[model samples]
Target: MELESYRYIAIDGPIGAGKTSLAKRLASLWDAQVVLEQPEENPFLADFYRNAGQHAFQTQVFFLLQRIRQLQAPLDPALLEGRFVADFMLEKDMLFAGLTLAGEELALYETLYLQLRPQARLPDLVIHLQAAPEILQARIAERGVAIEEGISLDYLQRLSECYSQFFYHYEGAPVLTVNTEHLDPAHNDADLRTLLQHIEEMRGKRAFLNQGG
Candidate 1:
């Protein structure tokens, strides 16, 4: 696929899947502007992790509102001039909202979400990062966020399954699902280069690049 045709390339995945780092690298390589999600901005994340049932709705709302606000800004001229690499896609927030929010909360969330849906810029390609739960757990541990210490493997597995189900039917843009279990884009130049090749050559609705496979 010609890189010229793509104005935005988004890297998406669950936590610890290296979306941020890879987004940075891809942006640097392609001279694309980077739009990264700021998780720290969500004050409810730590509490949500400790007691999901109690703080889930607040956490989800914070993220939803924050994302909408961020996207509400005019599209950066740099991003419009060149390709853009983003660590998060607005639609992916629904994956977490669906998993964590309950009946009344979810209904409220959906209403607000629909209202803000048009604010997001649709990407030309999305890189859906994937990894085994064990890999995800280890990476999260390595990050050493005190809040994530309470996150359970079962929760990560459920999140992974939810992502799989979402991308399975996603047809909005070309998607490249990569198994990033053993591939470290941070330290492995080979892995990064391989992904770059895919980003440069891919044109299909969906593709997979599993270095582990």
Candidate 2:
């Protein structure tokens, strides 16, 4: 599939794995619009990171609603106009909900998710970026976002596992999984060009790009 042939592209990964940066770079190269998740806009995120048990429901609900609105509004326009690259997949809401919510809270989240999920437009191609937990931790530390200061390696490991499981059975779109431990497409021109070539050459429902070892 050529890069231009994909109208909707979604790039997903665990936190600090650089999905957003790569999405932005790809969008620029393709002259595509970007639909990104703005964690900073979530008022409960910092608190949720500090005390997940206390603020988990609030944080999850806020993100769910925000994602739905973004998908319906800005993303809809871009999809109709031309190509767009998003940093998130709509199913990512459930991934986080499962990680944070429990018991009745989880049940309630599922109910809301079922109601809003059908409204989302599925992506034509999903780019699932992977990296070692240590690499993710280093990137997180280097970025130094205040809310992410409390992120633990254990949490990142679990998140990475969740992402892997989610994409393993993902059937809504063709998936291109790229190991990013040694690949830096966001800043390296050679890496970006190589990745674009790989995207152009993709001809299967599922593929792997393992430059990391």
Candidate 3:
């Protein structure tokens, strides 16, 4: 299948994995609508990063509701009339919930999630970006987002593990797992072309793409 064949595409990974950058590049290449997660818009994000135990629930809930609103509209003929690309997956909200919430908080979160989850639209294809935690941390530091400065290596490791576990059992969409530790598609034309070719050639329910490293 080619980039044009997929109606909805999602690029997902742990923080600092460059999913958003790649998503934007792919959207430009495919002339698709872009849907991005606005972490800066979340009032509790900085606080949550600084003190997860105290602010986890609020931050998670905010993101959950925001994503629900962002993706509620299905990919139908009435929308943009072309493929759409997003930086995050709707169901991954539960992965973060599992990592952050516990006891009564988790119970309440699960209830709310179950109620709102049905309205989400699944993607036609998912591109799962993977990188080592140290590499992710380096990239995070390079980007220098102030709130994200509170993100620890341990937290990134755990999140990367969570993403791996989630996608291992995922069957909702065709998945393309790309090892991006040594790939810089955003800056390298060759890397971008290679990834685009991989997307164009994908024909299985699951595929893997790794280049340069």
**Candidates' C-alpha lDDT:** 0.83, 0.87, 0.88
Candidate 3's C-alpha runs over 4 A off are 74-77
The sequence of per-residue lDDT tens digits that candidate 3 reaches over residues 1-213 is 866678889999999888889989888887888889999999999999899999999999999999888776644446646879899998899999999999999999999999877544578899999999999999999999998999999999999999999999999999999888888886789988888888889887889987765
The parts of candidate 2 lying over 4 Å away from their true place are 75-79
lDDT of 2 at 177: 93
Error of 2 at 18 (Å): 0.7
Candidate 2 or 1, higher TM-score? 2
Cα TM-score per model: 0.93, 0.95, 0.95
Clash counts for the predictions, in order: 1, 0, 0
In candidate 2 the C-alpha lDDT for residue 45 amounts to 89
Q: How much does candidate 1 score in TM-score? A: 0.93
Clashing pairs in 2: none
lDDT of 1 by residue, 90-184 (tens): 89878898999878899998888888775456888888999999889999999998878888898999999999999999988999999888677
